[model samples]
Target chain A: MIRAIRSELLKVRTTSLWWLILIGVVAFTAVAIAFNMLATYVTIHPGTVGPQQGGPDSLLTSVTGLYTSGQYAGTLLAMVFGILIFTNEFFHQTATATFLATPKRTLVIGAKLIVAVIVGVVIALITTVLAVGSGLIFLSTQHADLYLGNAEVLKSIGLNWLAFAIWAVFGLGIGALLRSQILSVILGLVAMLIGQTVVQVVLALLSSYFHVKWLMKIAYYLPSSASSIMTSPHGADGFEWWAGALILLAYGAVAAVIGTVITRQRDIS
Target chain B: MADGQIVVTGLTKQFRKVRAVDNLSFTVQPGRVTGFLGPNGAGKTTTLRMLLGLVTATSGTATIGGRRYVDLPDPLRIVGAGLEASSFHKGRTGRDHLRVLCAAAGLPANRADHALEMVGLTPAAKRKVKGYSLGMKQRLGIAAGMLGDPQVLIFDEPANGLDPEGIRWMRTLLSSFADQGRTVLVSSHLLSEVQLFADDVVIIAAGKLIRQGPVEELTNLDGAARQIRVVTPEPDKLFGALELPRTAVAKDENGGFLVTGVTGPQIGKAALAAGVELHELAPQRADLEKVFLELTSGKAGIR
Candidate 1:
């Protein structure tokens, strides 16, 4: 198992995927922070700037919410990293060599899972630092009060890290279940970005038509909703903190089980 | 009883509506090179994959050293396989590709370099696989397979893109591997090449075993069935006189009388008795190429 893990790490290190993903982290975080800084600057110097639509409260909200909104981009990078871990093997036909070297397919999958989590944590931490550093510099320049040590700020950062970790593992599970590199990445991004939103909107419209609140409650239990609950500030009409965590955990558990079973019986060809 | 023996028993694989391999069975003994021959779509790759535990067999078993591949504690140390020459990530360097396998097998890192050197790929080890030609990729695959220095080695079309010199090098490497008491099973469509070094031959067609035996025995099984060509000025009289029971007689494109199922001495005697002046009389030896064509052509059922 240790050897397999080492092999997986070596594979990731030798490829260019890591550098591409890190670039994504820097670009996404920088853009989000830049937008927040622009908003803060506009709020403080209203005389020099044209008439603004919103007040400082809204500006502050977007500024502080960089940890949540900006993290979405960072976690997506982690998710891509996870997807490539298995898809690259399938696309390159290296899976044959991989399975031949270690006939126990489960060990290979396990090693990939381990690497995914480690990469997830490291990427999440790096992006968080970027957001925090940029937020500090920008907000301080605008003479705005930056709550660097606030409980809510810290909670949001920690949960965002957890979110990235879960998303990475989730990507691995999806990759294993669907071995196509293009399809897995596309479907995964769709589910994260649009599928859940479409579901919530359709459910809300249906609930309004039927005059039933329970129909809307079903959205709260979805994997996306659980993730939003953890990554978003406060709560959004879903399970409490621990319950949301458990639901997200359940997704990971199910994905892991199904993915492992499918891969074990699958032919490398 | 050899340590690297491979025993496949009644191995079968059905891919949905098509039976890719049908009750195929063959054994590869240590200290010998076994050539697995088959036509296109003949299930050679499928069978090798099954043996390596990459694909699940529908029925029967393929074992190396009396144990299934999945049951082996460290499979790479016991069995090394190059099932496809292009089974590599084009983005990775050749050295890193072998290094990954070495790590999995728990071998020293230098083994990757050593194997590359053995395959004459040490100079190109630092280059990415994407830049390699087909022959270079084949050498890299062989280097990866030999990284662990396993007791058993299996290759599927290992000479697909190799030049004649590279093919000869591969042949020498495989022979040396077998000479060291290791087992080597290679599948190829090149009959003449397999004839060069194969001690045992296992032939398959339509996913079924057609024939298998020592190379010499299979080629020289029935001397009477060997072909004989007689070029003579009196083609009609020679053809008529050469007629015999169980003999297939036909006129060659060059107006020569071709006879099968009769010894060259018998043809000579009949020609002398008939007073047919023969310009040239020669026996066509049954070689691996002829046997392969005959067996696969479905003309004569050798198995």
Candidate 2:
């Protein structure tokens, strides 16, 4: 198992995918920060205060505004990275060598999961730090009393960054289940963008006819819905942040097991 | 571990309705190059994959060094395999590819460089596999196979895209591995190539073992009739003189006599006794290619 992990790390380090993902994350985060900064500058210049009033709100006006956009971009970035991690093997025929070297399919899947989680956390942390730091600079220019060290602001930032890790695992699960980059990415996008809308519409229509509000509550525990809950300031009702994390972890576990089983049974040709 | 003995017993693999490998049983002994020969779609690759645990067999067992590949403590150190084309990531450098495999096999880091040099790819080791030619990629595959210096090596068409020189190098390398008391199993459709390197030949056809024996034993005529071609001034006299029951004489394309079912020495003695000047008396023994075709043909009941 250790050897498999070491080999997986070596592959991740040498491939160009890692660099491409890093550049992508940094670029998207920077653009998100710039857009938020521009919006804050326009709203706060000429000594005009925004509607929101508070140390956290005034200090993080730019960052708070960029959160929605940054989170979306981060999810997409993680999905691409995750898809490439598995699909690249199929595309390049590297999986044959990989399996032949290890032969224990579960070990390989475990190693991939470890690498994906680590990469996900690192990218998430970097993007959040850059966005927050840039937002603070813009706030300073406006002479707003924003406190970066405030408990609420720190909690939001830390939780939001941690959300990246969960989303990364979720993306890994999707990639494993689908096994193709294009298919996995399309499925991930539809699940992220339209799954919630469809579920909400169904929930609204069925709430009057049936007393099964638990169905919608369960939907909130899905990786996509739960991830939003983790990042949002006000957590969803009946679903705490820790519960959402557990749901995402469960999804990852199920995916890893299924992927390992299929891989072990199938031919590597 | 079985200590370099590959014992495959009743190994069977099926793909839906198709039986890719059926009840395949063979033992690849140590200290020899065991040639796995078959026609296209004859399940050679499938068998090799099952042996390496890359593909799970539907039933039976294929164990290397007396243990299933997945069960081996240090599999790569016990068995090394090079299957299919360029299994490395196209974007990764050859050096990094070998390094990753070395790490997986628990071999020392320096083995990667030594393997590259062994396959004569040390100079191109740093280049990405995407830029490598087919032959170079094959060389890198060979390098990867040798990384752990395993006791048993399995190669599937390792000389597929190689030039004559490369093929010679591969033949020598494989033979040397066997000479060092390692078991080498190579699968190829090219009978001529295997003729040069293989010490024992296991021929399969239609997912069944057709024949298995030493190359020379399969080709040599132990008791079978041998063809003796002869050119003589008088064809009729030569034909009448050679009145053997199995002997048949026909007119050659050059207006000479083509004699069959008689040895060269028998023909020469007959010609001398009949006062006929023998222009040519050439004995034709069956070659491996002929024997392989005959054995693999559908009429044979091996399948």
Candidate 3:
């Protein structure tokens, strides 16, 4: 297992995509920080008026929304990483060499999962730190209460990081199930964007017409619907943070199980 | 298993309605290069893949070292195989690719360098595989196979894209591998190439093993009854002088005597004794190509 992990790490390290992901995450975080700082400056010293009605907290709310977008961007990148991890074998005909080397196919899959999780967690933590640090620095110029020590600010950063990790796992699941970069990316985009919107709209229409409030609750638990639980200022649908985490975990678990089953039984060629 | 022999029994594979390999049974012994000779689409690649456990067999078994390839602990250390058209990750350096496999197989990292040097790819070690020519890619594949110094090595048309010098290099490499008492099974469509490298030849056509035996046994037509052709002034006298049973003397295109059931040397001795000036005396042995064509043509219909 240790050897397998080492091999997996070597694969990840040698690819140019890994460096690209890291650069993208850091660059997006910096852009998010700059945008927030510019907003704070514009609101603090208006050209015509002395000050704005709402302070940097409104800016914080918008920036926090941007953080979710950034998290999704990171997740998209992870999806690409995960797909390449497996599908590259097929493309390069390395599956034969890999299976011949280890012979135990499941161990190879397990090693890849472990590597993906470790990378996902580390990248998420780093992105969170940079995002929060930059946001706080920008907000400090406007004399806003956006200090890192602030309870709300700390909670937001923590939840954002947690959400980022979960999103990464979610990407892994999608990548594994689809097993092709273009297909996985399309499925991921649909699930993250159109799927959630469609589900929410249908559930809203159903609840309003038939008084089926339970349907709305069910929709909230769906993979995309569950995002609100992490990104919402207050937890969505009165569900605790742990409940949302569990829902995401369930989604990832199901995806992984399906992926592993297909991969193990299918012929490598 | 103890001798590093590969035994395959009742091995079968079907791709949809097409039987790519059917009831293929053959044993490749150690200390000999077994040439897997077949025409194009003769299921050579599929059989090799099944032996390495790259493709699952629909029925029967293939074993190396007395265990299924997947069941073997440290398979790469036990068996090394190179498939044609195998592509390494284009983005990675050749050395890195071998290093990753070495790590997986629990072989020392230095084995990567050794394998590169062995295949004469040491100079191109740092280059990405994308830049490699077809012949260079083949060398890299062979390097990967030799990384673990395994007991059993399989190469599928290893000399496909090589030049004359490269082909000679490959022949030397395979001969050395077999000389080390390792089981070497190499597949090729060219009979002349295998004729030089292989000690034993296994011929297949339409997914069935037509013949497998020592190269000498497959090529020698001694069992077909010796035949001799002679050109002498006295054809009847030459035929009568060679008083062998079941001897047939027939007219030749050049007005020489065509003789059978008598060795060429015996005919020459008979001519010397009979005072018949011989114009032609030659031994006829069936070539490997003729034997291969006859066997595969016969098997093609039954399959």
The per-residue C-alpha lDDT of model 1 at residue B212 equals: 90
Compose the digit string of candidate 1's lDDT tens values, residues B105-203.
788899999999988888999999999999998998888888878999999999999999998888899999999999999999789888987999999
Least lDDT summed over 10 consecutive residues: which range in candidate 3 chain B? Answer: B221-230
Please give the CA lDDT of all the candidate structures.
0.84, 0.79, 0.78
Interface RMSD of each: 0.7, 1.1, 1.2
CA lDDT, candidate 2, residue B29? 87
Writing each residue's lDDT as its tens digit, candidate 1 over A60-117 gives 5566676454677777777778888988999999999998888888999999999999
- What candidate 1 gets wrong by more than 4 Å, as runs, is A40-63, A67-69, B243-247, B251-256, B274-276, B298-303
Steric overlap count per candidate: 0, 3, 0
Per residue, candidate 3 scores C-alpha lDDT tens digits across A18-68 of 888899888876676666556555555555345554566665565564333
Q: What value does the lDDT take at residue B301 in candidate 1? A: 33
Locate the minimum summed-lDDT window of 10 residues in model 1 chain B. B294-303
Top of the candidates by lDDT:
1
Error of 1 at A98 (Å): 0.8
Q: Rank the candidates by DockQ, best first.
A: 1, 2, 3
- Ranked by lDDT, the better of candidates 1 and 2 is 1
